[model samples]
Target chain A: MLFVENRELVVPGRLLAEGDYFAGEGTFLEGGKIFSAVIGLAEIREKSISVISLQGRYIPRRGDRVIGIVTDTHPFGWILDLNSPYTGNLMVSELVGRKVDVFREDIGKFLRIGDAVLAEVREVDERWRVQLTASERGMGRIRGGRLVEISPAKVPRVIGRKGSMLKVLEETSGCRLEVGLNGRILIRGRDLKKVNAVVEAILLIEREAHLSGLTDRIKAKLEREG
Target chain B: MAEAKPEKLLVDGRRLDGRRPDELRPLRIKAGILKRADGSAYIELGKNKILAAVYGPKEMHPRHLQQADVAVLRCRYNMAPFSVEERKRPGPDRRSMEISKVIREALEPVLFLHLYPRAVIDVFIEILQADAGTRTAGITAASVALADAGVPMRDLVAGISVGKVDGTVVLDLMKEEDQWGEADMPVAVMPRRKCITLLQMDGNFTPQEFRQALDLAFKGVEQIYEAQKEALKEKYLPSLEEGR
Candidate 1:
């Protein structure tokens, strides 16, 4: 039988019980004749229970795009802040097709501090440090645009199914929009009003992306205002 | 927090749903709310609900890091998997760590650590429903838990978020405002000292806009601090009179 190890479920407290099936997070297993700490509700899986622990920096996976800000520059690469404990290094060679010799003091000419960019994750070391590369078109420094960051977990919702949400933003606001899978969005438009409108729309999407019938609502709003 | 639709537009310069810029959506706080914890409180600010618990001023095991002069603060900030629109994998993420660290620091200054030497003070904050200002709300609720635990503190810390949207600085942005607004600045303040314990900003803002946002945050903090004090007083004052 499942029983609560701790107190009521209204507060931020732990719940536990010895059982074969893992109850998982956000659940309380409560009943009779139970032992405390027998099983934690968070991080539990089928027939397995895992303790919650915090360590290591965030690492990026292949096909995962992230928002990065250039923090430091080196002779061959630039250091990037990926909104995680780990810092990513983008090699200069990845930016250009051919190896171009440059003066050591002139690295800042290419990228400087506080410059936001979009990059794809290439590799992650065992230590959780990320190595990034920007070797493809539509993947590099964001130019003449506005950038917005949201929770990384919300990235998929922002993109929507088969690029449907993105299509709406582009078609209505007439902005060239790029969304990195890592929760960064870039919106570029000559009209400040349109740019502002698109940014607001994206933010709304991030907040309410879980709800259904969102596209039609956003489309109608944009058409009426834009 | 749910998304904001346009039909929800402005009514008399207020939100489409009729909320003022400085007005809170709705707030609820309950103390002594958990039986298992030494002290606990559940706080709901708008759609963001967080529960905070104080577990111990107990013996430190492994016996290695115990200090002779003060108690160590152990804090864990977590988001439930179903707290957001998408189900998150159950674990601590980088954002949670950063928030936990700040919360630990915020409590350290307020708590009288020397009172519980060689022991540990454990604070666990969990986000039940996330809107825009989870951290701020967490910090506020944790203070209530600490107070309920009878932990001595100089003053309560209050947190709030201020931002610029459409060239207008607003106080206590909803989730949608935070996501779409041009800038968001969350601050944790000590009302007694008028000093800030935690501050973080994202998005674009001019220096002037930053100052304006901070001003708005200070205003918001004052209002929240009063509510916190009221909640604490309501919880403990009657009990204190009974003890006497």
Candidate 2:
């Protein structure tokens, strides 16, 4: 039996379900009952139950696309803060797709501190050491896009199902948005007003992440403001 | 040297504020009030106003403090200069320092700290008004802020003070009762599990009185736990109700 309806608001430790249900992310089971582990909207799919959290710091996972800020430099790579507990290491070789001699080559020419980067997580060790790669097309040091960060937990909502919300955001506002799993979003648009409107809509999704029918509301908002 | 005791703490079964013994002061709690902090809460308990904020589970600066197996939980309990009749000096006082340590320990038991090793979680509790039981109120508010931040925990910790005034046990002591009470004990408990995470005592209590005081504290904490859960839910549910 599910104690809460689908999309119902749930707080940490609120009983979610019982019996054969499998607990998923943001939920835990104990003593034959599944309970939420964060304040969010309860999501139920068949026998699996999870809660979509509204607020949380980003935790990096392997293969996640992230936008990061270069914060420091070491011998082989530049350390990037992924807006998360763990920082990602972007080796110069990985960024340029070539091997370079440390003594002969200057990595500073590749990436400097305060540079914003779009990279993919290559690997994560048990110690949470993350390695990043930017050699892929359209990945590397980002330039000339207004950056906006919402709560990382709300990133999926901004993307919507199958990129539906994102398509609507870009099409209505005439902006191209590059969203990072770590919550950093970059917007490029010819119209400044439209860019700011996209930022407003993203923040609205964060504030109302627990509510249902958000995609329609967002589309309505974008059209009304545009 | 001895201070004079008040003439009557309980008159016709009512305390000075017209609340019965074993009764808690009025409480109002709001979650996620601040914009910058990862999580924040504001609480008013019998005029003892407190605000709590949680940050991080991010990097722990000064590197040497990083724990290999668990995240470090840091708590700071500070009373504002204008909180009381007499101005409190700025900075961490001895009482505040001790309260900070115990509060950290109180919250550590429930957190899934191992999930974020090498990171640090900071809980800041600021007392804007002082009417006794500030530490307990701070703990209650801090736990709410932690939950608002989405920190996974076994359960929420609820806290209250129990004391003996006029040789009778009471729950949630006001400043006046604290000043004249025979004993003052602040306690924090994981209400669902009924496990004590914090217990500090001053003055006197016999074994029997201590047991009774714990009973009262547990009951008070249970009520506080409900309110804490409600505070988090209230932030999202009502707006959702209207949307539907």
Candidate 3:
């Protein structure tokens, strides 16, 4: 039985369910009861109950796309700051997709220390050592784009239903948005006004993601502002 | 406390502040108010105004201080020079340093520190206005800030002070009561488990009176806990209900 209503904001230690439900992320099972482990909105599915936390530091997970800045370099790879508690290691092989002799070749020719890289988490161990790969299409170094950071939890809302909101944003504002799961969004457009409009729209989504009918409101806002 | 007692602290059944002995002063709490901090809260109780900011579960600095198994909880409790009636000196005094230590311990139990090993969680409390129960108020605000920052915890901590004044156990003592009452005790409790994370007493209390004061403090903390929950809901959940 559900003790708290679905989509209701629940604080930590709140009893979310009591019987015959599996606990998911942001929830813990004690004896026969499930309790929320963060301040977030609760969700109860067919057999699982979980909470969607509204605020938190991002934890790196495998297969997650991330945008990171190179902070330090090791003999094997460059450490990328994932805007999370843990950093990601982007090896020269992963970035270039080829093996190189460290002594014979300078890896700096491919990526600089301060360059931004669009990458994906290849692996993460129990100790939070993150391995990043940027050999995929449209990955690797980011050249020039306005970068905006939002709450990581709100990234899904910014993308919206099957990329519907993203499509609308691209079409109306005439801009392409490369959103990272780590909460960094890169915007590229010829028109400065349209790019700024997309930034505003992203901020609005972050603030009002909990509300409904946000897509239409955003469309209206873009039309009015554009 | 003042050396001399007032002729009457309770008129009929109400205390000097026009409240029952068990009533708490008005509280205003808001979470996630800061832009830079990971989590932050602003609280106003009676005439006391406080701000709390939480940072981390991030990497521990000083390389050597990182605990291999758990995150370290560090807290700082500071009062502005102009916070009280008299202008106080700035920086960490011995009293502020002691309060900072106890506040850290008060919040450590609820946090799931082991989840983020080799990290540190910093809780900073700044008192903008002084009241009688600043330490309790600081703890109350810091816990909310921690939750706002998305730190996982067993439960939120709620705090209050109960004191004996005019032979009566009054809840949430006022500044005047804190100074003039016969005894003042501040208590912080983890509301879910009903465990005392912080307990400090001064002045005097008989065995029976101490138990009664604890009961009143528990009652006061219950109310504070409710407010803390509502404060968080009001920030994120109210919009969803409003859409309907």
The prediction achieving the highest lDDT against the true structure is 2
TM-score of 1: 0.49
lDDT of 3 by residue, B117-206 (tens): 777899999999998899999999999999999998878999899999888999998888888889999999999889999999998999
Which rank order by TM-score, best down to worst?
Answer: 2, 3, 1
- List DockQ, one per candidate, in order: 0.01, 0.66, 0.63
What TM-score does chain A of model 2 get?
0.94
Off by over 4 Å in 3: A171-174, A220-226, B1-14
Error of 2 at B150 (Å): 1.2
Give the distance in Å from residue A24's predicted Cα in candidate 2 to where it truly belongs: 0.8
Worst lDDT window (10 residues) for model 1 chain A? A32-41
- Which candidate order results from sorting by lDDT in descending order? 2, 3, 1
In CAPRI terms, where does candidate 1 land? incorrect
lDDT of 1 by residue, B31-68 (tens): 66886676678888889989999866655665687776
Query: What lDDT tens digits, residue by residue, belong to model 1 across residues A161-212?
Result: 8988889888998988878765678889998898988888887775554445
Preferred candidate (lDDT higher): 1 or 2: 2
Query: Considering only the true interface residues, what is the Cα RMSD of candidate 3 after superposition?
Result: 1.5
Q: Is the docking of candidate 2 incorrect, acceptable, medium or high quality?
A: medium
Instruction: For model 1 chain B, give the 10-residue run with minimal summed lDDT.
Output: B235-244
Chain A TM-score per model, please list them. Answer: 0.71, 0.94, 0.96
Put down candidate 3 lDDT per residue, A127-204, tens digits, no spaces: 767899998879999999899999888898889889988888888888888988999999999989989999999998
Chain B TM-scores per candidate, in order, are 0.90, 0.96, 0.95
Residue A198 of model 2: what lDDT?
Answer: 93
